[model samples]
Target: MKVLVFLLLIITTITSKGWAQDCLGMTLKAGTSYEMSTFNAKDKPTGKISYQVKDVHKEGSSTVMDITAQFEDEKGKQRTPYVIHYTCTGNELIADLSGMMQSMQATAMKDAEMKLKSNKLVYPGKLSVGQKLSDGQMEAEMVSNGNTMMNMNMVMSNRQVESKAPITTPAGTFDTYKIKSDMSFESRVMGIPIRNSMQVVSYRVDSQIFDIKSETYNKNGKLMGYTLLTKAN
Candidate 1:
């Protein structure tokens, strides 16, 4: 039973299906663009991030995603990355944020990978309106080389992520579901070997159109950070 549950979570996280009409088969619409207007913890509307995506090419069963974005950092400086590469196999998705990280000192990429693995949250089969996917129940530990990281148990769910980032203008809003999950991982930063339980809440949104919104929150149930789909080709 435990193995079955874990396998399901892995599949859901890896596949992350949806966007059949907009993304699959057809190439990304040329000149596609969008923007993310971020908000601080106070929810005070802050700066903005803009992206332009182009479909470089398609190979076999994968669609190549080329993305670039411009945003202001905490120090109020405007910066943009060259481009981030991502690919989608059917409904599964993968992104490379290392390029973006070069300009900004954010831990977003690392956090994203961890969140992807930990949350294991995605739509069950296809992407559509009013569809929901529950990972049922999962319990595991962060292990490395047969060493214990942390023991955790959680129920992860995923719905359609809506994108509200604007295209014509360089600003917009994104809204998504509040994911209520629980998990534990080895505390590498904390330098602790003890197990700790965390009640995880990941914020996300789906737009009226086809863009997706995804964000991460701390245990306080506040928006610690987020990921936005600013553009698609």
Candidate 2:
């Protein structure tokens, strides 16, 4: 159960960055970097994730960005680093789930082989209050030797832009759209099924590579944790 909770925290930390580029407006430059700091329900500092844009290129009409990510404990100990990719095309941006799985494999399931099938997360170039967004899903199975040891699934649904607001973080203040979504996770480990659900609210600036802030809440509407953009360059 503890392992599952830790994995969930890591996922939340990653996704809170918004994963969308300012398609049609701004280009992501290589060597750009950002950091997000995570906190627990009690607002206690937990850890932080750092991201650096390593490469940017054009794939026909699409702009692809390769970003390297690393997580560090509150005490400043670093973990294994991984890379993720994001793409921008036409009026939309997409975040690749396969890149996210690489981080998960390196951070949580090091010894097991993971097979993933995922629907990538999407964000439109323009967002409006009350606009509904598409759902995202991912399924992963962990195998050891010839036996499947765990099956995990996650779904993000009911996504909508709630409002436009100003959000302040250590990185600075920005005009952002507040987006809300319901997130659920289910996993079967050694044949025992476990389920968890939460609500996520993220403040996203259209021109920024990282979100200003994101908060998670329990089913009862109690704050569970949060991630804040602490630095950007």
Candidate 1 per-residue C-alpha lDDT over 79-140 given as tens digits, one digit per residue, 9 for 90 to 100: 54545555556665444433332332232222222222332233222333344445433333
CA lDDT scores, all candidates in order: 0.40, 0.78
- Cα lDDT tens digits, model 2, 1-233, are 55444444554612224344345576577777989899988989989988898877778988888888888888999877877778888688787655556666776778899888774778888888999999977788888897988888888899999999998888888889999999898988899999988888888877776668888888899998888999998
Model 1 regions lying over 4 Å from their true place:
1-22, 25-27, 73-76, 104-215, 225-233
Best by TM-score: 2
Q: Spell out the clash pairs found in candidate 2.
A: none
TM-score of each: 0.47, 0.89
RMSD for all candidates, in order, please: 10.2, 4.4
